[model samples]
Target: MSVDVEGKSLVDLLDMLEPAPVPEPISMVPQTWGWSVLALILAGLIILGVYAFLRHRQFNAYRREALIELAASDNNAAKVAEILRRTALVAYPRRKVAALHGKEWTNFLNQTSDNVTFTDGAGRQLVEAPYRDVKADPDLEILARNWIKSHKRERTA
Candidate 1:
């Protein structure tokens, strides 16, 4: 079945031809765009998480200090009242908080929350009690702490 090729066999002729060149090995190093984009997104998320953590700590710093002072007061009504006043000052304007007295001060405190009413409730003692040399009510301390923890900054008229 072989054709004559200058008296050489077809197999010999075929063998004399060069074999197809093997494709050059593909480059081993991967393309950088995909890896670079993935790394950038990962870095952004890490930075966002760190920022959120730091902002949260900063926001709670006031509450932590208020609790520490409340604990140190040790049932002293005058001291507790002073601490409350100082805490309020930080969150409210000086004029709005400075001149408040007795029922007015308690009313202001009550306005900030629905959970604790300072005027006609357990917190009534915060008014007259501070003026006298009386031991602070533990319940009032708890109420004040709760209010400080959850009170919104919006003032109620």
Candidate 2:
């Protein structure tokens, strides 16, 4: 190693008189704004759900239609009652026939319409009517059959 003598070190230090510049500290802390953003996302999701509900007001429209076909093809009272209950749910969802059990189902059928005669009024069973009636509603039956035929023809074509 070459050694510098004290006599040679005097030239470089005398020319520099300015202080060194200091750097600003950069923060790397985690974000705290996620809660509000998450809440907004949740609100948007709720609005989208409400919009979908309004669009498809009747959840069981297609189900009732299919049940109607089953009742028509079978000409069974049980099938008719099931379809009627589905129709009732679509029409009056708050008074859901699907929730009925035992005697309540029978009662519901009697109270809802004279068009539907039930063995029991309160516990309106879905199927007992078709089996007991022996004579089905021919007008409704014909209409259902025609509807089924039309649908079948449309599908095939």
Each model's number of backbone clashes?
A: 0, 18
lDDT of 2 at 138: 53
RMSD of each: 8.8, 15.7
TM-score of 1: 0.70
TM-score of 2: 0.32
Q: How does candidate 2 score on lDDT?
A: 0.52
Q: Model 1, range 13-95, lDDT digits (tens) per residue?
A: 99877789899998866577898789889999999999999987886688789889998988888878888888888778899
lDDT of 1 at 111: 88
Q: Identify the leading candidate in terms of lDDT.
A: 1
What's the C-alpha lDDT at position 123 in model 1? 85
Global lDDT scores for all candidate models: 0.82, 0.52
RMSD after Cα superposition, model 1 = 8.8
Give the lDDT of residue 66 in candidate 2: 67
Error of 2 at 153 (Å): 31
